[model samples]
Target: MLAKANRITSADDYRVIVRRGAKVAGAHTVSYLRSRESGTDARFGFIVSKKVGTAVRRNLVRRRLKAVCHEALGDGVCDVDVVVRALPSASAADWNEIRAEVLNALERRRARASIDAASQKGE
Candidate 1:
């Protein structure tokens, strides 16, 4: 579980991240990330819809996603707000599969950002 300070708790914050953040999609998950100017640590939110499964299955998927996020982004690697939405396919995925998808998403986000930065610099 993430500490209160590291969790994105407000609906408005989630909306902002979803609307304005850069996104990366993998086979079983999609992640949106928005960098904050002042924050030194990253914060995260997870969304597992009813479409994924029944309450028990949904909760299980949520827990797995949380653990993946905690492992992948909990370190002070970047100051960003991240919202990870699980796809229906996630219901059947294992921990290694979920972790790989999450990491791939983050890496794609980083690559896109660097490309954007380079373009802005006219490089």
Candidate 2:
């Protein structure tokens, strides 16, 4: 379970992150990551739409995504806001599959941000 402090509760926060955050897309999900400078808790939001499935299926996918986020919560994700949007394929994905996809996307997004920062500093 994700803590309240680690959850993004506002629609505006979701919109801003989804629009401005760096994106990392996987077969089962798309992760949007934006850095902030305040605290160690990385906030997370999920979007499991009708395209993924009915209420039951969508909720299952959302729960699985949340579990992955909870499991992977760590220092690397600090000072960031993440929104995970489930793809249609996610309804059929098992926990391990969803976990791998989400975790890898987070890792890749962080890598991309670091690389961009390094390049900018070198210029």
Candidate 3:
């Protein structure tokens, strides 16, 4: 499990990410992210809805997401708030596929940040 400092704990934070932040899409999941102003560690949250399955299935999906986050963006990502939402397809996705998707999502998030920063600078 992720440490306290590396977890999103508030509904307000999650809502901000979902409503105003940019998204990174994966095959089995989607990540919404917002950059943090002061920190070097990345924080994360996972959301597996009932549409995925029962308690057992949701836990499995959460576990898979945590592993992918650790493997893909573990060290490179900076301080940010991230929420990973699982799709129904996630239940059947293998580790390799999930990892690929997570990486792709991270990359997209980075790119979006760059664009947003550039636009802010222009204004």
Best prediction by TM-score: 2
Candidates' RMSD to native: 2.1, 1.9, 2.3
Off by over 4 Å in 2: 74-76, 116-123
Which residue runs does candidate 3 get wrong by more than 4 Å? 114-123
Candidate 3 overall lDDT versus native: 0.81
| Per-residue C-alpha lDDT of model 1 across residues 32-77, encoded as one tens digit per residue | 9998775467788999999999999899999998887788765444
Clashes of each: 0, 0, 0
In model 2, the clashing pairs are: none
Q: Quick one: RMSD of model 3?
A: 2.3
True-structure lDDT of candidate 2: 0.88
Better of 2 and 3 by TM-score: 2
- Per-residue C-alpha lDDT of model 2 across residues 61-116, encoded as one tens digit per residue: 98898888887785447778999999999999888888988888878867876897
TM-score, one value per model: 0.86, 0.88, 0.84
lDDT of 3 at 92: 84
Error of 1 at 11 (Å): 0.3
Candidate with the larger TM-score of 1 and 3? 1
